[model samples]
Target: MNVAVKAPVSTLIQQAAGRIAPNWPLDKLIAVNPYWQMRQLSMHEVAVNLSWLGGVHVYGDVSHYQHVSDDDLAQALSALGHELTVAQFKQQPLKQPQPWQNVAQLADLERDSEREISWNDEVVHQISQFAGDYFASQPQTGAGCDDFYAAWLDTICHDHGLEILMKSKGLVEQFKALPSDATTLVEQALTMLGVTDEAQVDYLHALLLSINGWASYSAYVGWQAMLAGKQNNVVEQLLAVRLAWELVLWQQLSSSELQINWKRQLAHSNQLKGEHQAYVDGLQVWHLANEMQIQQGLHQQLRTPLPAKDNAALSLQAVFCIDTRSEVMRRALEAQSPSIQTKGFAGFFGLPIAYAVGSYQRPQLPGLLAPQLEVREASSGKLATAQYSAQWQKFAKSSAGGFSLVESTGLLYLGGLVKNTLGLGKAKVTEFGPLTLSKQGKALPLSEQADMAAGILGSMGFTDEFADTVLLLGHGSQCQNNPHEAGLDCGACGGQTGEVNVRLLCQLLNDAAVREALIERGIHIPDATTFVPGLHNTTTDEVIVLSGQVPEQIEQWLAGATEQASSERAKLSASPDAKQKARDWSQTRPEWGLANNACFIVADRKRSQHLNLGGRSFLHDYNWANDKDFALLTTILTAPMLVTNWINMQYNASVTDPLKYGAGNKTLHNVVGGNIGVFEGNGGDLRIGLPLQSVHDGQKYMHTPTRLNVYVDAPKHAIRNIIDAHDNVRWLIDNDWLYLYQLRDDGICRYHQGYWHPVQ
Candidate 1:
């Protein structure tokens, strides 16, 4: 049922540019794999092309790939079938463009000429203003993401025509009037600008390269059009304006006699040598080697007896997100007591709901998903009391405003600030609290809740195994002055805290009426078992009780989790002052933020029970035997596996090319539009991915940029059926974005080219 998009080459380029993700607001920050949609091209190919034409360092030359680990080098040589040794690498020519050929030299075409304005600056600024208005005017629930380009094309076509350019060389009329639609506009503008149809793609690439951040941001909104087999008109708007500007600028600089051949220059710039191919091979070898190391390690732990596999009477059972952060906590908790059991599920717990508070609605699920339900926060819980001050809310939100207000108060503010700094002063917030059962208010009807309960239980393979106290745990972080706070939270919850989804699901599952309906559907809950809602603070390493009283033994067991968390934290950083750095507002490195992540296994615990994952694997609880129809496995492959891949590549791109993809030095980042995005140094482009500090240490990268390795303990045919059925899944695996492994009785077998290759 997939629709094919039939378009001209010019339209294709615009659509491709528009498919790139835009950086979200600081509050809704999500990890995005920059090349997810462009998986048709290999990483090296994309990197090389991006660097050559865009002037962006997505991935550097042979020397850049040399940063791979020693083990990775050994693997690269064998897997790549390329000749690369230290001697040969030394002989390799530089992969990047020479100093003279670079586009940077094109800035000042004629030094002697008196130019009143910069064409690039003026066009970019004007376009940025138009883009901002177009996007900000529409809400997510409205047509804002798509209307910018449509409106621009319609308005411009009404006044401007080719006659305006025939009369005046000025860009004012060019901006004011234009052709009726994108195609006519682009064709006419190119004719006037002296750019031929053959060079339009290169021209579009050059223009998009300059304002890549804004273009990418606009593309993020255009995702809806791409999904519907339509081109992103907004990106076309960008292409049109910038292309028109080029025509006007060419007219202005016609007298300069600057011999600028954009097509010829770009053609020479994007060429790759045989040695550069070897360099790309070596980089892949390192990536493959890194992947192999994890697979071998995970395969080694396959036979370890899984806890609570049978219908054992467990004292406590807690379900946590399949995030890599939860893997360690699950292990620590299980080790605390033999009776304690842990299960990994998607943080949203199967209900795709947008978390809303009255008039304010936020996208709290995975940024990729279209929220199907709305869960509102009505009551303030405890914070709604009279003691809460309205001014304190503003103080908590804005640092500059709060500091100025406190400075005006002088001594009165001094005493309070000092007390707050000492951790004694409390400014109660009358907003954003724990979601209770009453607030849930049967969001999912009894039949719907019954259906969801079955899906959740069936996915986890928990049909009859109900514990004394079943805890649904979600995670969130608390930090000051951290713009990427949401990036540190649950990915399954759409970059927001997963506590609300977890609590609501727990309440629905524990309801007597819903349970009775589920029992008829063959899922039975024990009378003695009670479901509790909880949250895990990954930063502070604290487990907070949200609702329903827990047993005293469970409470005591939870209290000891802090010690285990500290032990894990010690392993993460050797520095004793690391904890102190977390409190430091100036510190950019809040946490590793899923660094060194490699494997995503959707199988039982026994597959990775004894191995020291080091918080690098995402463990989703799945029982293949229970999934006879393979629907759950299909969902996991398409949804969680795909989402995990995005997370993997986000870190990979950030580590490989921090200059372009990453938000440059955290110290220099200036918050743009309050919380919408960031600027590296006040102006150039919007900063998209994680800051450099999050991935790299002072010396080298903490995260090894590589593809995610996915291991599934399902029948080979089941895995194969879904992969063959879904083009998206097949594209990712076959395209080498991720590796798929089938867990068999004999050993782990990798799927490749319609055959299963045994893991070496």
Candidate 2:
């Protein structure tokens, strides 16, 4: 193949590199859009780009062009109407998307489909496994870690991953000769590809895209770069090493049949242009338009006359994460206990603590933020059996113990598995610490603790007014054998349950010294007020109370609250099968994890209290009157609000293009390298985002794909200032990935082209 360079082909690689973000391992899974870096481009453009370059189908299934039901096809045709005439419409289901599978699937459909090239899947698997190990080889935190790339470069050079994989194939010498530094590595990779100058940037971007997840992880850690002005060296090094690895692999494949014509593929990709890109873009608009119409109806229906300036003092107040799943419970609990008001905030509750779970330190903050404080777990009182804990940990971590222990332990173990599998046994639950123990560490400084309390109160709109009994309600999901269990956990708490955050914050607020300092900070809590902690089992749709030493006057309220929650939930759920579903070992649809999320409203509870949001909106309570300087507004826009947009996009991509965006068919998924990641079937690339069952049910899709509709009740200038301050946010809004709405006393105004227009 006498392949010359394709076009100038100079800028694509760098452009793509800028767009990729990382996917965390399954244990610490956070919702992410796999095509996140490509968000700046139109869906059709991204779809076409991947198809030409990697033989990936971004808009449709690669297994085949997604099959549209006859009903869906009819509807589409009807929508097209005169544009696509009935007589000329030959639906007849487009031909088999491809005649071949696997390695040969890389052949471009629109280009030369006749030439089939063989790809070695086994070698690809081995390489991918090694890549997983390489990333995990270093300490979660390390010495001289100022630069991730610099640290990563050191790790790769010193590690045996590359050497081990190459030695058996007789490429150890060639691998060792590869440049160890990122700069020299990039230069060599570009030279190998016959690309130079600006094209080197394009080539580098393409190489990173080949293993985009790792590239994203480095960039993902440099998250503040999205808002900050500094460059992220770690991201640069990550991309460089990725390019270097591919270069070494390419050299090894040079003499094998597995070698692909690099220059030809690049040339072929560049030469291609989509004839129906505009049409595809147009077709995608209705889904977004439909979402807009639905949300507006709820906005109007849910709208209510504004409440009195001072919120009414309540018998009880509970705070929950602003997750869409929490929307239902908050609404239900309020109805069940009229005097018991409920508020929504981030699950982490402003305390970014790294929790001690066994021997590991898990960050209980959102993935976008780094952990700041470490909270250790200790066995005490009734839970003081450290010996039992050690034994349990060993059994849980050991694969042989998990299987053979049950086989040989006794009839009790053998019979238990059968009963559980048959769903006849009682449901098992994961229990945590008694949470009754408090740290005896030197009392945190009064100023720091007081400041934390004040911030929490101000952020949740709870200054001055205090309920008799306040509950900090944390939520988590329970399911058997689900690798993505962490995905269903609270995002604000890293990927763990919100229990620790709730318990710790409650203990901090309840401290007498903390209260004294909080008064000085101008946030007054009545002496009669006490904070209680509890959990809402989302999978079972049940509420469990873990009330500690609060004032003993809340016995009646607790009883009434639990009963009403159950009754209200029963009213909403069908057949009350949540518990059954939770217990089912192989159950796929484990409580509709963020399936229908659509709108995000950050305003006073009164603004959206009347409308039944159908668990589609993430509601965060904020009063514009209290936020005088826009500090609170800025934090909301940059953090919780931004996180909701991520959740929305992950669901959006999974539904719109499941095969390309989602980890298809959980049953076929094989977990790779312990908790590193999962590969679909045997091997290819590491899968990112939610699995298919998480998005689609067995019948039709449960989630409707839509860009996040953000409704912020604030002055237009305040919202505009926040937008102007962040370049990354502007990229999302200006590029049309999300819609921003500002609530004015007059009406709702939609933002477009740097201006606001009345929505109505």
Candidate 3:
């Protein structure tokens, strides 16, 4: 339930400022108030100021807020070029303050009541006891993916608040005191208790922080109870926190009400936790087994229709394939398989084939390569089909699940992903896909692929319905060659024979191993992709094929789309050019300006029922678009919240507030392109571009809060600076940096190969 506490705009700031002062890093405070207008401000302005106020200093520089409001403070900062006149402020003189006026103040004034001190000692003791118990109950084993539980033990401990409750406060303080030391306070404490090694210590410390965040939420719940003059249910509160935490962790978005379905959550926990734990354990064991296999040199026969030696001697023609589908898959395949060969009749976007393998299977002999096959789509008056070769009858099958190398009819093969020969020298990675299994020689089970795919799908905000749609779309066995007409040519694999294997390349995106490699190598992943598919009416071509050389903004759109979808709210896709504009802001920090274009007032489809509630059109005209012909983009951001209620009808209703979560931030970057696209800057050229709603360079609270340091490496159309062309830059920004680990210049960031790492 949302506590609808409103406050005088200024009052909210004052209260939050006061309450946050003692706990916040001074540097952060200063940075947040860079404009430092002491006079009047609007409610929207207040929201912008407070959005990241909590998580900034914890991860970023904490010394940004040292000075209080003062004349000298303004002058000293003006050296950096900032205006501080009260005339810059705007107030709507809405006769009186809103009803929830002073709620933050109330919390600030009643701080003591909010801080439940009664269970402090008890909570600490219980935590310590649980920690001891957790450590003591160990070394148990189970078959089939339930053996190794050590890897995630810290996560479990932290989730239960048993890892750091006893000494979290003191540990954080000690770390603060010894800021120069590479070792954390938790490390020192554990070392004293005879535990050393950096990885283990890091793990333990992370465990503490994880628990500390939860403990803080627990305390907040208690405070809320005190404010309400009644005891709140712990189960409900904890469940809410769990659901909310999951949302921020996975979806990177929040809804208005922010309520979750408890029944669903409970069911999910019961179904997933234990099974997931077992999978992790099994993975560890599998890894160990795979190592043994590699050491012994292992191999597996590809399933064929015929017996052993029958197809052995045939001159086999192998055509290397590349799958340049998704960023992640493309990168992964490229990184995993990088062997070189000829470019055959592969389509513009499909895998690059060296040559079409001709089919001819024989008994007690290998299949012979007849001739390269030329595959073409059937159009009007074109040959629809062909017949098999008579030589293929020479091969027969074995009942023990045997395999066969069959000779296919000439030109039975289709087009694949091949690059022009000219771009080889500029390619970053040449291969992808783990053709060779891991040292453990373990293959990802098909069953596990479904689960893993689901996880990935969830990350992209695919509803059950949406996922089904995608599956159905891809169900046909016949592969189609999808061309990327967006002028995105592959430089790395642009030659007659593509140099970079796009299939392997896509998998390297955000692959743990790839990320580790990049981090170790110290290369930055360029945030770039092709387009952002909107919520509704996203073209099948747009959904699958990203045309044009990969643009940074398109990548951001992909990541943003996935993040938003996870949250279960619909978002319209920004144009490819609009995405580029957002990417441009990454070049420099943002300045305060009216961002009219950035904020879009999209009609909420979920709440269309409430609009014109009294009319027949309310029920009849439920479609988001009224049959108007305009490019449509749609996406559901934020994950579904599992909820339950005593009232069965209300139980499954989504917890949503269109005014909050559905509301778009109208900052300079967003509004500049859509509305006023002119701003006077220090440079000689007048800055005319799309404005971003909020400062894109500021800290993003996604994934534990980190500063988004966008570097304008190189822009094709050179201006003095990226921020100058506000109109052009509006459509150039990349919001998918989180998804890209490797930056490939050939307009493709293939996954599974190698990816780039973000700067810490």
Candidate 4:
């Protein structure tokens, strides 16, 4: 046990100090023990650090070491469940008292109050001398001490996860020595299983043949590392990192091959939560469960309460939602709405208005100019003087020629209603008000929209933003293109294709009118449709951004810049055929799909294949040339409609509310005119893997569950109305809705409140 000095022990101690000081005062211990030092440390640094934690408390004073004989020291370590190191026995420190007061004084102080003192050159000199003298009187008996140290190391290593590192190292060495052609087919299978490296091919090939070969190999290496009591390398760290997947896969094969009860193994794995190997253990359980279809029996249950309001005047609660997905908006309402009162106010179009915080809590209304009113005021001799008239002429030039005739009429009505609601007198009525709209038709500004919606909701007594916030909380990706225009619908919601067409814009505006007029007729919408515009960022050499600038300024600047940029771009151009080729390509690729569903009929070979496409690329890749073909695709891709149809088929017509699901008295196939099952797709392809893995001793595997989609085909208006009314409709209150559908098994479907909860 003649230990040779390698690197100065102080160097090793300094490194160890970083790790231990965060938890305890290691620096203070070294400061007092001037004689207890060694030099030329190696990879044994970690071991030395760990060992210090084991016995430093006993070395309180140098004389205290004299009281304990070598045997006593050995016995003390043995009592604490550790073996004395061979190096320590052969090269033991002198059992003599030195400047032990320095150590005593420091230890006596409270842990928090102990201040660290710098180790001067003089202190370093004393420690170096003591380290040499300390190891001068040991015997040359390495075997017994080695055995004791090895045993002690194993115990400590096992407690701190060092055992796994040992196992991984041994496995790597063993695999390197493995013969190349020992198991060709097994290796081929492992390669197919994702073990691609040539170096690992032989090992993996051998690994797959035995169900627990990898696990056993890893465990053996861990045991060896524990015995050696050394720090592990990179390869040795694999057990804790990927051990779970290996364990799970191994268990999966074992239970399948040997017919063993793996449930106990799965449960036991969960207890190893703090262990580095826990992930491996969990993976094993997860993989086995997937193979057994553990989630198939679990069901989702839904419940919708009846509507009840506190105030009669504001008895009906309406939610205005503007999302690209109207169906999701509808589903959200239905899932959360109560039975008695339905949420209302589902509309999208409105005149653009800017909002600014006004005096008091009430918003100020801006009035529109009516030529008739202006003439009357002039005739009544209320006209301004010559100085005012000169200023008024300038103002009139900047006012966009007052408001449109139609807008003036709408504004007059809106202003009167708002004035009456606010209890404002005519004397306070100014030329400007909140209800005024921009002469050019466009959706209201975002701030104005939020404020107006808030006002409308305020009148109903819902002063909190929670409900309105919920109405706005839908999924969307951020778009930053076209600072002035937002990309809305784009055929997604049966609306306009783009800003290029004024017809589509007019359609949207007219629809807004229809909705506003509906409210005027006392037909309040409880579920409001929300409009969300997607944004895109377009950057080109000629492009220049003037964010927050007025629209007029942008147009004026662009008018001058466009001509120059166009001329410059025209200079570096391709042949005319190249342009024609692009144009031809664009014409071949149509943007719209049949029935406004965004599905397309591409003439792949003139038979005209139809695809049920809606989102982005559905038109190009999948579309239908005929209505019948489109219906087939709809049956497969849209689950909402498919599930609805299935309910219609399985139920008796007389009992249920047919209108709720858009079903008639006829059977599902009769109503739709055909039976289709192509939408189910293969179960394996549709499965989304469960987010868990399992491992045993150190192995893992993954698991997944199958999910399906359903599609429906309906007109735009009908679909919008359906989505709007969904929140209040009680799809469950009628027993006939459930019984007729024969959906008793809380298995395939579960009824929580009012809608069908599809089990995944």
Q: How accurate is candidate 4 locally (lDDT)?
A: 0.23
Q: Give the candidate order by descending lDDT.
A: 1, 2, 4, 3
Please give, for residues 22-96, the per-residue lDDT of candidate 2 as tens digits: 667777778876666776675556655555344444443212213333344344456444355433443323221
Task: TM-score winner between 1 and 4, please give it.
Answer: 1
> CA lDDT, every prediction?
0.67, 0.64, 0.21, 0.23
lDDT of 1 by residue, 541-568 (tens): 6677777689889888887765686578
Q: Which candidate is the best by TM-score?
A: 1
Candidate 1 TM-score, true structure as reference = 0.85
What TM-score would every model get versus the actual structure? 0.85, 0.79, 0.18, 0.17
Error of 1 at 576 (Å): 4.8
Local error of candidate 2 at residue 664 (angstroms): 2.6
**Ten residues in sequence with the least summed lDDT for candidate 4:** 22-31
| Candidate 4 error regions (>4 Å) | 1-164, 167-169, 174-637, 641-760
Error of 3 at 47 (Å): 13
Local error of candidate 4 at 290, Å?
24
| Residue-by-residue lDDT tens digits, candidate 3, 1-760 | 2122233322322222222101001000001111111113431222222222211111111122112233433332343243534223111121111111111212122225444322223332333333223323431111111211222223333443322532223322321232122122222323332222322222232222222322222222333343335443321222222222222222211222222332233234334334433332222222222222321211111111222222222111111111111211112212222221111111111222121113311111000111111222123332222213212311211101112121332222111011211222232221112322111224434343333333332322222211100110010001111011010111112211122222222333334544344433433333321111111101111222211222343344434433432222112122222222212312221111111111111121122211211100100001223212211111100000000000000100001111111112222211111111111221111111111222232342111111111111122222122223332222212211111111112221212112333321
